[model samples]
Target: MSLTWRISLKSDEAEGPEDYFSSSLGIIFPDDITNQHGDAEHSLIYTSPHLSKSLLIDLADPVKEDDRKLFSHYLWNASLLLAEFVESDSLGVPLDNPRAAQESLSFDVKGLDTLELGAGTALPSIMGGLLGARRVVVTDYPAEPVLKTLRTNVVRNLQPAISPAGSSTTPADSVLVEGHSWGELEDSFSTTHRHSFDRIIVADCLWMPWQHANLHRSIAFFLREAADARCWVVAGFHTGREKMRSFYDADALREVGLEIEHVWERDCNGVERPWDTEREDDVTERKRWLVVAALKWIQIP
Candidate 1:
């Protein structure tokens, strides 16, 4: 399903052009999964296209008054796209993005330490684990309700092979569910896991302009200081392209010693094209394209 929208920034000026800009961009989270089940607590079983194993992810109610708006409980389309790409890359299955300029895109996390930021349902992280990533750290906002759901998803899908961070018997490939608030530098998660991950996945996290700096900081700080280390980013334009463009064009990522290696536009149908800023912002068409990119740490002299 295409997560498309034309948001009106002003309450009183609803009749005017919907393009008027504002900080509070209306983000629509499309619940594309129809197989969701359970009454009191909802859950969905996801089966990857490339991988044989299936993941059972529990959904937390975000509308509850006291839950602090835990919207990360649901799986977004970008997450699924990223997961599909990674699984294809991991299994050496060639991606069928004919419109892509690079001809071929290479990504595989096998035997590497992987980390996922804003990992709501952790689909990508689960793919990394199943694909033989040396370690997979799944993290999200440090709230208990958010972390609880994240933990449940990770444990239920990857346990026996998964354990908490402090486990003495934790193996090299164990999936660890962690609580991480973006840009919290002095916290335990920051201190213990800095410059650690080889492969970092950031999915559907650039919607909030207010959180871009924090997200960039966390990405730069955690991504390993190596020539091969990369951060894979997948974001949708449901919040509006202008708001999404601000995060990339602000030079904030480059300022932090990270550089965009490559980026492309892939629609929901698995068709890919070169990233074009000059393209028309068709509200209906924009939802079909999800911007996918790879960022690597700048090598110092």
Candidate 2:
């Protein structure tokens, strides 16, 4: 359960869970959960080793705060691109070549640590565990009702396979869910969680340009300063680029002392990123699109 691809549906039909699950591309929803209103929150947690069925966790109707519109309850296209990049042999960033560096990482994880910021369904964080991260902390805003769904999905996704009576389950300590409000570091996080992660994932969280400064403060505190540590990011303007211009710019990241190493832009459709062929003009067919990047802390002289 390392990758999460959410497909939200609005259904006028009051079909049972079975019908809903069957209609999905892959992954099935849990039995007995009823749809809320006309909206059904369905997500497919893609398994590792291949693009096969893993687990399905149905999320409850999300209640987004007025100021947090971009942090909307629905899943954005960014998560899909993020998952593909993490699993692709290319690792998407040709300049930095993240895949090459990741291959050097031991599958056993050992001392590796990962964290996912604004993890709506927390698909990337879960992928980190499957990819051999020693510890993965999935965090989002402190919304109790919403956090309940986040916590449930993590447990449901990470649950070990049906084992023999004598056997144990996937190490429980591998992942933890937390409610973290950005900008208020000292009040929300402790030194134990600070500068501890070897890899960090922030996907589809940059909707509020006003909060970019606060987000940087949180990233600076939590991001490890080690030479090899990197924070992988995928972002886009689903609501429109004008809504969140700062996240697409370099000034905010530079102010936080983070050095941008690689970046790639893709249209919303699922085309092979970093196109294998000559540059095509049709790539810009979509006015709204997604952007992915690999960033690291800028070491001081």
Candidate 3:
């Protein structure tokens, strides 16, 4: 595999876009990597369902996997699937992008409230706003640098879709970025904003099973207690030897007053992924699990 990654990061203290991508944020992929059949690794360009221009995402250096900043750097295969799900489900406006839109769950996204947990790079959350969601609040662990990167992506990808409120630092408009650590449910947001989002997107957040209870509670707390409210959860088993052992903590989710409506194991391509990878024809054996479930409000019986 010649897919070696090189990541160049801009300092969070950078003054402006011009100052941001100076020598400090120069392109990582040199000419050498381009020669390799499978090695274009600095950044990935993905076409959006609505945008005419392709979205460019900076990749994370594999060497810096230990760093927290690397979390929002790389573009995951699961993120692509989630993007496709959005493209398919969203109200289709014909765009010049080569990507074809496929229809998924049929629901009008206009004025819908949405929140995405662990919104690394915020591709899905950005899509929600592009699809006409009234308010799309993308959140990740409370790290200024990470939150800044997510906001950068949201602004970069979605310009015509959302208008930035507050200031360049703290955006609170059609699409807002927030720092939300799972477990501290009530502390993440104000009570006035409780049960605010109608739809929740949880992409690539199940890697840490130990935090399943927290993830579940956060989803329950942020998600509106209504029959129509739903959450789309997707995670890939590409890495982490132990993460693939199980999909999600079903018991913990049920404990938090949520129910799993449907679960599908599919490959990077939308085809069904078998339980046993040995049986599947995919040489990569990489698979993603898509779970569609609604938040069940605890009834006082």
Candidate 4:
């Protein structure tokens, strides 16, 4: 009759003085629906505890009123998946469900300097901080309110790591949260980090087919900042598989000067499986495809 959820936090085994840092929000679904698509944009909802008592977020666009509620539901489920990773210890974390595919990925959060684009709730960046990345910068579209919420959530969730006393023992790694759009990336990152990111992580950022060019441009600028920079871009889409063919084609990536070195299947347990071209019809129709693409900046030695 009632929905119940729980949140957990786990420790990491990386280079930081602290062993790990993580948290989870649990949800117990009521026995009402049986056949449901496990999509984050269709299953999760989050409420703010402020006296005003407003919904914390609605990830979908407000213009599409009918779809607004559906997106909220999906965000609620995604929050749960993100909480799980925050609480886990492993570097390559598997997502609990397909809805979580967007937030679930391991990055060198502790020692390596990194940047995360379209951070949504900033879960991936938080995980990076816990993993011991020397510095982790999270950015989203400048016009979106999601960026602010992400900053708030990061501070709230990572309070222990930011404390003055904790800083002495664990050494607080920089977790910079900011508003950044593809249009301003070159200027923004250049001024702040000054060409100093070792790794770049992007998740679920492609979908607006129109923005593909801008996205590619932004990625190129960042990768060019460092000759050895490595980028991992994960995109999750449920609408239609054929729509992505143009975007995922090898030539498109090559045009941006990025060479796809590996294409791996990511299991729920977070292990990378060898590439398999087989397609599942049922899954193709219902769930979005989760793609893990690794790219290295092709700089001639």
Instruction: Give the TM-scores of the predictions, in the order they appear.
Output: 0.78, 0.69, 0.69, 0.61
Candidate 1 C-alpha lDDT tens digits along 108-181: 77789899998877878876676667888999887777778877777666643332232222243467888888
Candidate No. with top TM-score: 1
Misplaced by over 4 Å in model 4 are 1-106, 161-173, 183-194, 224-228, 267-280, 283-289
Q: Tens digits of per-residue lDDT for model 2 on 112-186?
A: 787878887676655445444567788888776557767877787655452112223335686888878877777
Q: Judge candidate 4 at residue 51 and give its lDDT.
A: 13
- Relative to the true structure, candidate 2 reaches a TM of 0.69
Q: Candidates sorted by TM-score, descending order? A: 1, 2, 3, 4
What tens-digit string does per-residue lDDT give for candidate 3 at 104-169?
A: 344345568888888777877766666567787888877666677777778776655332231111
Error of model 3, residue 109, in angstroms = 3.0
Residue 216 shift from truth in candidate 4, angstroms: 1.7
Residue-by-residue lDDT tens digits, candidate 4, 25-144: 112322121111123232123321111221222232333444332232223222333334433422433333332333333433346776777666555555556445667677776544
Displacement of the residue 212 alpha carbon in candidate 3, Å? 1.0
Native-referenced Cα lDDT, model 4? 0.47
> In candidate 3, which residue ranges exceed 4 Å CA deviation?
1-43, 58-70, 92-108, 161-172, 188-192, 240-247, 273-283, 287-301
Residue 5 Cα positional deviation in candidate 2, in Å, after optimal superposition? 9.1
Clashing residue pairs in candidate 1, if any?
Answer: none
Considering summed lDDT, which 10 consecutive residues are worst modelled in model 1? 1-10
